[model samples]
Target: MSMKTRTVKVGPVMMGGGWPVSIQTMWKSPLAAFSGPGDPSLLAAADEIRRLAALGCDVLRFAVPDETGADSLGALAAASPIPLVADIHFDWRLALRCMDYPIAKIRVNPGNIGARWKVAEVVAKAKDKGVSLRIGVNAGSLPEDLRGMEDRAAACVAAAEREVAAFEELGFQDVVVSMKMNEPGEVERANRLFAAKYDYPLHLGVTEAGPLIAGIARNTAALVPLLKDGIGATIRVSLSDSMESEVIAGREIVACAGIKKAGVRIVSCPRCGRDSFDTHAFLARWSGRLYALKDTLEVAIMGCVVNGPGEARHADIGITGAGDFVLIFIKGEIARRAPLEEADKAFAEELDRLLG
Candidate 1:
């Protein structure tokens, strides 16, 4: 059963309350990259934001290091195609400054933002503006007392609970909570514990999960179980890669966990000695484009036809090498053939036809 937690609205996107799991990614470049004197930088950032949205990134977050960064975020938020989230650290004032803009959400740990009143001030402003707030609690940034706990996952939970209590005290409930740890086991345990204790929607992720492959593996291992139990509302695959890569990884993880039922699905076999087609190169070229498609497509890029057609027979469309030529099959039946050199072009034509 899906965990029906409290729903928080970030602009037009709704998370929890049985909504589909949303994918988020943080902006890698500093806010200053788009905070130049003219509109050029902001326009460039807007283009990047649109591209991420096309790749299925539901929420885009940026770290607000200072007041200037907050101002930059406001400018970007005005033109962003998707909802923007301001990630604030020790300064509650930054969060308040961010609220002055069109930002949809503010992310900060109540414990780290100085005194309780500071948190209250930000919370009050967020409430008045109808903006949601995410209480982020990372294992590495826990309070001093919580850091000495024997169980790190429990420590994460405790920190989050305290922040949630502060929000509750002000009767502010437009909140979401996240507790991330670099270790996959701790991440899973923390999310499970939090889900059991509160109905506040949980944002799932594994912090500092390294590069593309390693990050995907760690986040998948940690998130699959929690998502399977319907514990997460929004997810971000925190990869040390491009924001686009993170969003794509999050989508695939959601699909693999069976938490999502719609979107393009790609199935390709691992190449072996009998392989004729360069499956690796073909996938690397088409993965992003294929995933960006809105239609429900089951595309299979197989190595050889020996078992390719039979193996991916259930696929809507497939391509594989058959000796000297490439074969494009539809529903297990060969639909078209092309020479090795022209395979990509032929596949593109067929793909366009299918998409059309």
Candidate 2:
């Protein structure tokens, strides 16, 4: 059981209050083009957001640097199916401006968002708009006074506490806090301390967590322990990679921690001397579409007949190949066989039939 905190509604999804731990990822492209209400590009962006949502992303955040960014995000928020978050820095006006739209949440560093009154103004606006705020405390951007503190984890906890106090003083309680550090240990330690001190929802993440392989490893190290101990309420696996990859990694982490069992899980074999099938190519062609599935299905793609049916006996669907022929297994039993060149089409037909 996860730590229970106050429930904050983000558009259609609910965070905390024992709700499922949600996944968040940032938007990669420039936001200017998305401001147009019904432009082709804007429509395309909406379509992409829908795809992301289908892949188990509960919240999507975009950086709002200026009024233009606010406009762009506002327009997109009007049509976004999932909740949209505005990441604000320095200027408090942009935070104020972003609330004018249907933006679900605002992420701000109270330490960097200037004097108390400025943060107050932003909080007031957010409260009026039913927009919850995320106190995003990053290790690299601690307040000047606390920068010299030797216990960095404690400093992070203090930073989040200050912000939490600020919000509480103003009678605003819809808050989520994240204390992120590049190091997994610090990330876990800081977040653990904060959760012990407060009941606000915590957003778990290891900031600037490197490339794909290393990032996943570092995040898993920090997050799994907190999650298993019932500490985190929502999570973002920050990566130097695509947003889709980030969302998928976040879901996998949550699942691995036994937080939630949801979405499609893809299992594949690493090719070796005995392998005749191209597992990599097969996954490359099918991974995205498979992850987009709403139903929870275990899918296995193996390099040969040996690892195919036996290892994936419980998989709802399995596919593998050996030389001239390809085989498709349904529940560990061979259901279809096709020539090498025709395998993909044959699998697609069976998949469609299975899904239908």
Candidate 3:
């Protein structure tokens, strides 16, 4: 459970050590078409960013495919409420351009960015601008030198170390490292290997984690253990779902792992034969209202009264289904009962009162 203490500055953000794990989401908009010289795409990105910001994203990343796309940085940085990170694949010039603005961070793998001096130049520019760089290493795009290695974890670690070493050599220590894989087990193993050796901030995520359910499961599998052991600094839930959903899932992961402080965690039991009312629909109906609350709360929605109260004793608020009625419990006390028809509004009103 040894984690490196190396801290990195992502714009004004300081990650690693005791820093809370941040939730980040990527933009789905066209990187190439999102901007222009004077007609900056910042305003366009603003609308999308507002949505993501409302979902509580800690950082937002957009791909800088080319130079024209880089112009969007100013508007995004100017109007964006959260830190902005530029994702650069091979172009060192785009990396430089990203550093030119108040960009918070850059995701670039020195191993693939080409030429030693180019890497140094980018690193130097980032250092000069006081911008943090995330040395992103992915299993899908491992270095050719490590292509034949039977152990992907070793290769992943080597790749990360190579970039970290390069950044360290440039007298720049503001670096966060990630070793991402589609397989949860591989991602965990590689991160485990890295955590054992270095103290640099580790960004945890499962790359290309499929559609919603599978992606959440995979990300949960990889993160739970590391998080419990105090291993991760920032996290991203990469799913083929909406960016807001991904951000929500990321926050949930942190909450479930007990690494983050968020409002209102609703613990609902899986409906079984004994459940009364429609537990599934009841939960689905009230979940959004709970999500809308400004303050964080720990809530439980149980299927039946049999074990509902006992199981929900730890939650700040609880609800148990009984026939066509729902018993709303606050702090383990039965507060009121509402019919199935009025359950949604009733719960929303109660939660609003509870939050207020």
lDDT of each: 0.89, 0.88, 0.80
Q: Kindly give the number of clashing pairs for every candidate.
A: 0, 0, 6
Greater TM-score among 1 and 2 belongs to 2
Candidate 1 vs candidate 3, TM-score winner: 1
Q: Which regions of candidate 2 fall more than 4 Å away from where they truly are?
A: 33-35
Against the hidden true structure, what lDDT does model 2 obtain? 0.88
Residues 53-89, candidate 2: write the lDDT tens digits.
Answer: 9999999999998888899889989889999999998
What lDDT tens digits, residue by residue, belong to model 3 across residues 1-356?
22447767675666886767777989877654444444455566676787677667779888888887676764567677788999888888889987878889989966568787988888889778888888999877877897678788788899898877877778888888899988898899999899888888899999999999999999999998888888888888999998877888987888778765655577888888998857678766666556645577788888887877776666777778877888887777777799968877787777667767
Q: Which candidate is the best by TM-score?
A: 2
Local accuracy of candidate 1 as per-residue lDDT tens digits, 236-310:
999989898898889889987887546778889899999898989999988888877888879888989787877
Q: How displaced is residue 93 in candidate 3, in Å?
A: 1.4
Q: Which ranges of candidate 3 are over 4 A from the true structure?
A: 1-4, 31-44, 309-314
What's the TM-score of each model vs. the native?
A: 0.96, 0.97, 0.88
**Which 10 consecutive positions of candidate 1 have the poorest summed lDDT?**
30-39
Return the top candidate by lDDT: 1
Sorted on TM-score, best first, the list reads: 2, 1, 3
